[model samples]
Target: MELTDLATIRAVLKRHGFRFSKSLGQNFLTDPSVCPRMALACGADESKGVLEIGPGFGVLTKELSERAGRVVAVELDESLLPVLGETLDSCRNVEVVPGDVLKLDLAGLLKEKFGGMETAVCANLPYYITSPVLMRFLEERLPVASLTLMVQKEAARRLCAPPGSRDCGAVSVAVSYYARPKILFEVPRTSFYPQPNVDSAVIRLDVLPEPSVRVKNEKAFFALVRAAFGKRRKTVLNSISSGLGLEKSEILTALERAAVAPSARAEQLSIGQFAELSNRLEELKNEQ
Candidate 1:
């Protein structure tokens, strides 16, 4: 809210004598308004519990504690304990847990924090752990309401990308299978104590119970999708052949049956088309 946040963040670090580590991506959001926007984008409810990752200075945690029914903030940097304690002390609803968010079983942690509370996630995430953190929640298959994260703007574009875009890769398809993504807001580079070179955005992902398609074998379907995008310039047939260790003729036949052109590339196929290809693969497997 004030320049004091930068000063307070620094003073807290000085009193405790802590230095920010570059490897950990330790950029703290000093602008206080960003927290409530994050909570809102995340759909934080007084009745729903939230798990936040990388609560560097707990600036966001302070805001979340007011809006959510319960807030469990996972902080990897132990250096900010005194800072977090000072900020979150008045807020009995917030509990700061010191641990690497990647190693923590998030769903299990949420349950432990407040049993039977509908869970959601809100975080000012570290850029280094972006993929792993996003994948963990997206693949968890838990009862989370949604995940609203502050990530690199580039990552946001990738997550919300449509088919046929440069950003549409394996991660894009994998994300689409889990939930619909939307970029809610863009954060300026100057908002942090030490401004990161890259700008960031707040993106929300509404978790789905299952994929939008009716595929028999979801695992194999995703494998096929990943394989298809493994090489961007290659045709679907060639990409899949390399991945599945099948011949070009075999891939062509499968594509023909699915009504997809073998000349098409991975990014050209929609989720349903991919499912269709997967179904045809099953038929081919059965025939053999």
Candidate 2:
């Protein structure tokens, strides 16, 4: 069956008595070209294991199964389970697991399903849960080598944005600390069965061996990052002092010690600079 075909998808949904749920962000891909391109971009191969999220109708699941040795697709919508079963029947390598990716024990899941093979994630992610899903992938520090995701266009820009770019956010900095993100291509809103309001872009994040910078405390480093960007309009000095509940003088001193300009905004500093600032702040906190 041509899973990406609009008529076929509608027929499958009708046969299964399926209805699209806006809350679930159930937009099935209708573009045959997009899934193949996403699979190729993911660099999936016979030696790798692929974990796909939100495998609506198994279009992308089938594509990944063709390239990877094993594919485990996590679908939160229970109604789609049988539909996936039917669509992915011939793809002996693909397994559709019904559960929320956010709540799953990813490390355990990876160990069990992808033990002997290198792992990667390839999915046309639900826009509503994009940040949480990506955060789980990054914060867990999973063994996955890379993630190739189709996300909202604006989100793609923010994820791949450089430190000083206007598109950069706290999440952008956090993502950069974990991986090298780049936007590979754009998919029009019309590419889906129920077209989304916004266009989407395919982004690939190659996981780094270690964090981009050295910090005394990982918690303190991310806390500082969150504090820095908490008030977008404020200078780094102001934001840190207010967000972290530190005296402005103390924040200024830490910035000075780190050789970062106190006048710089959070977005103006690179991950390394933030690390330095965070380490200096930690030293001051210890002295007090």
Assess each prediction's global lDDT (C-alpha) against the native.
0.84, 0.93
lDDT of 1 by residue, 1-288 (tens): 232277777777787777889999888877777877887777777998988888877777877887889999888888778767876778899989999888977768877897998888889888989988898877777668788899999999988888888788878888888898889999998888788999999999998877777777878888888889888899999999998788788788889999999899898888888889988887888899
| Candidate that scores best on TM-score | 2
lDDT string, candidate 2, 84-137, tens digits: 989999999998888999999989999999997999999999999999999899
Q: Estimate each model's TM-score.
A: 0.95, 0.98
Q: Native-vs-model 1 lDDT? A: 0.84
Candidate 2 residues lying further than 4 Å off, grouped into runs, are: none
Off by over 4 Å in 1: 1-4
lDDT of 2: 0.93
Model 1: how far is 54 from its true place, Å?
A: 0.9
Error of 2 at 108 (Å): 1.1
